[model samples]
Target: MTDRSAFPRRREALAMLAAAALPSAAHAAERRVATVDWSVLETLLALGAAPVAAPELLQFREVAVEPAVPNTITDLGLRGTVNFELLLLSRPELIYSSSFYVSSEPRLARIAPVERFSIYAPGRPPYEPAAAMMRSIGARLGRSEEAERYIADTEAEFAGLRERLKPHAVRPVIPINLGDTRHFRVFGADSMFGEVLKRLGLANAWTEATSYSAMAPVGIEALARMPDAWIALIPPVPPGALDVLAGSTFWNALPSVRAERVLQLASINPFGGLPAARRFARLLGEALPAERGHG
Candidate 1:
């Protein structure tokens, strides 16, 4: 027969032990995260953390090529107007966003801890900010080592790509996204694609100042200015934009188009991090001809 006083002490001991084990058990459960930006989602996936939810997932699939998001994750909504009710129901442990969406931080904090990551700043290279963002997010997600490895691997890959693309090092290339038959968004030095071009030892034909968005909306006449430039078009070009451009005398007049010095890359997120940089490098290497001649 157990004494009542001893029974009470045993119960207290059991409770203490259980309390002590609670933290470890909680740590074992993967943290649930929700990302409000595609870049954050890409970085999290690269770090081996699957977010519980992300915004614009369908659009992300169309633009972002690598580090695919698993179907288990929920789509909260678009960037500007996320479904707060659905977000609450998801019960995320953390919410990651960008500085562009800071207005929603206070509201997001009510549900979970909110972290805002800034990837672009004045007077800094795009890759510098992107690498820093990866490390910062990685440390928060307990993936610091993986983040370091990713940066190192990207650098190694870039070095190899540089050697492989040495023949076209002097070639000036203009990367453009078609907005319509008459206008296109030309990527310049401030863009992620610009950084990739620099890494490959290629020159950007469009030297004019561009918005922080890294691209400038210009008329088709702009392409005519860089007659010696190789035009690289991003895939999934606006529906019928090319067909319309093909008929335009302004488009056919460009020396690049006439010489067949144009390359089309597989879908790549220009705003993504290390994985995107690697993808851009590989694709450009494959697209460029072995010699100075056209592909």
Candidate 2:
């Protein structure tokens, strides 16, 4: 039992099937694809392809926010928990995924061919892989031209951002996403944020190796050690973490905070590809200059 009674109603949804990823050279129509990975989904959007279906779209909206997910693409559910029965009914021709969900690939492949990509590798920077994925996916989608254009445009944007930041690249940048006031996730050299910061001609404050490019659930005391750094706080701020930080003497007394060197960056897909790199570079471009003398 998978409750076959619901199959007939969902059959109509099959026609609106999402596009596949890294498809074969045949043609776009031959492979009906969907994706459970946000990075893949966003890459599809950036390449101007109609994604078959995307997982955790609502959350993606809050975090990744660029090239924009359309209202037309269906939300399959969270990345870890997808609607397998719905996928089965739709008869997906393929499924685009990433290393983040490798354990789920077998299950996903049961419904359709599963093509997986990885940007985050142990001790390796994700930027290059992300660019390669864009081109590869674009070629598979028969949109290689568009992929090159996007890559060029993203690189040009990064170049412009680097030039814009040159004068004030004064301090090393510490990028973080708050898990709560007491603990947070810091992006290291292998992270998209850290690597992009390097691309933007800025130094990353967290020099140590990280477990898969980030170190999480770490105490605030760690951040206090980077006295001359600019704290780049990535959001969706943990509810009232800011309020909690506002009153605590320990928070206010931190050298970076006391010097007003914190840069509040909008949320980004920390392990993402080109679109995320572009979004992050843009966020830094806007935030850093605005905080110049004020810091």
Candidate 3:
């Protein structure tokens, strides 16, 4: 009548049920995960696992190197966005993404277990979040060793470039996503691109505050200030835009522009995971002028 008499029996029954269910729970935890960003996809690939689906596989088609996993991953659209309906249909075990788009859309969790982690956060200084993300994702992917190796290799390569560039006295470098000859977004010290520049021992010309990328748009008026700076154009644009930039006075008048230091890199997501960082190094080295070729 006191009801306390039934509590002991209920606890015993629940304990028994939990003990019986532990094995099934362990099995359920082993489901594979898929990611939308190329960085995460690269991390997973390095970890010896492939996602069920990924967007823009062709962009990193060389790195992925494996045939598509049948009935698993489906390419929905571009990076930073996914087709929710297709995502639901794909039935990923887990979905990984950056903080920007993921936090903006919480409804994705309804389809699968969406693990929210900030690969990069807005307004944070020093850009430590990116390296933290790499280490965290590396641990998750069981490839922390590979991640360390990559980090070391990148640092070494950067050091070599620094030595090569020192003779010429490395100057500030402004990496711009050339929207046009008149307007451009200059990368600040907060971006991965900026970090790559820093690794090469080049200072970022823009010292102003930045949001996510620490990137702010400026007009050609600012170009006059960075006479010794080299401009790295990003996203290797269409032929028409290239031609227009090639012919514009705004592009022609700068010191670095005249010295043939300006170069364009193909559009690859510089944010996200380890592969992104590695790819950045590879792309930068390829785009930069050789020691003999420089002034």
Candidate 4:
């Protein structure tokens, strides 16, 4: 029953399969793309233009939670550190990045052509810039129409939220992420949170100019100045921050804290793109309705 003639053909088929899996200089027309930037990665997901490789999907899934990533993509490793070997194995035809990886651009170019996008600028809100980045990435991926549609969809959602949240728009929202017991980072008008809150027709409580996006390690005492605003406590809350706050006199004395006007929101990446704007807006909408407390 052993057909010896088929043996040679079977071995040849196996060799071809192995070659296809390797990072060789060949393709079936579809190009590979890799990115170390979460913003780029999430934008790609929104456009249905998944990259061949991305970094930190594990953590990204928890924080950004929008336009879900595909299951087939390769994880290049941690976002803080790039895994050069894994990236090489992925054999991306192109690599998309943000300013955070500027120093590594030269090295990245060695493996594939690299394109960098910038969204954060000191003075202006990044909403338009973020949308521009999406359009740019979509053009690169040959998904320009999809990108425009996604941007339109996101804007439409915000427009709808602006109407839905009109009732609870009485008080401004002060968004803060606790760094520890003593201090927290506040989102200013230039920040994405501040920008989204504005788009939703709600005022941002913190009006001071931020250095870039958020001002970190701000003293807790400063919150006492704005008593009527709603304090939106963002998570990744330090190990025992809540218990610590429960026992502190100053924390209890803050009117927002005492009146239970604090809205506990999920982790929304402060530097994300349109998808992030939608995520933050949706979370606020769901949590701001009746029975809104400790959420």
Which candidate comes out best when scored by TM-score? 2
Report lDDT per candidate: 0.81, 0.83, 0.64, 0.85
Kindly list the per-residue Cα lDDT of model 4 for residues 1-295, writing each as its tens digit.
Answer: 8899999999999999999787544232124888999888888888776888889888888888776888888888887688888899999889988987898898899999999988887878989989999988777666778889998898899998898888767888999999998899999988889999999988999988787788988999989888988888887799999999999998999998898887899888888988888888899888786444232
Candidate 4 least-lDDT 10 residues:
22-31
Tell me the alpha-carbon RMSD of every candidate: 5.5, 11.0, 9.3, 7.8
Clashes of each: 0, 3, 2, 1
Candidate 1, which ten residues in sequence have the lowest lDDT sum? 22-31
Q: Residue 119: error of model 1 in Å?
A: 1.0
Candidate 3 lDDT trough over 10 residues, lowest sum: 62-71
lDDT of 2 by residue, 97-126 (tens): 999899888898888888889989888999
Task: Residues 45-141, candidate 3: write the lDDT tens digits.
Answer: 6545567676776655644333223334577676666777777776777777756556535766776676555655454433355556656656665
> In candidate 2, which residue ranges exceed 4 Å CA deviation?
1-27, 290-295
Clashing pairs in 1: none
What is the TM-score (0 to 1) of candidate 2? 0.87
> Which parts of model 4 have CA positions greater than 4 angstroms off?
1-31, 290-295
lDDT of 1 by residue, 110-207 (tens): 99988887775443457887898899877777678889999999999999988887777656999888877888888778778888899888898988
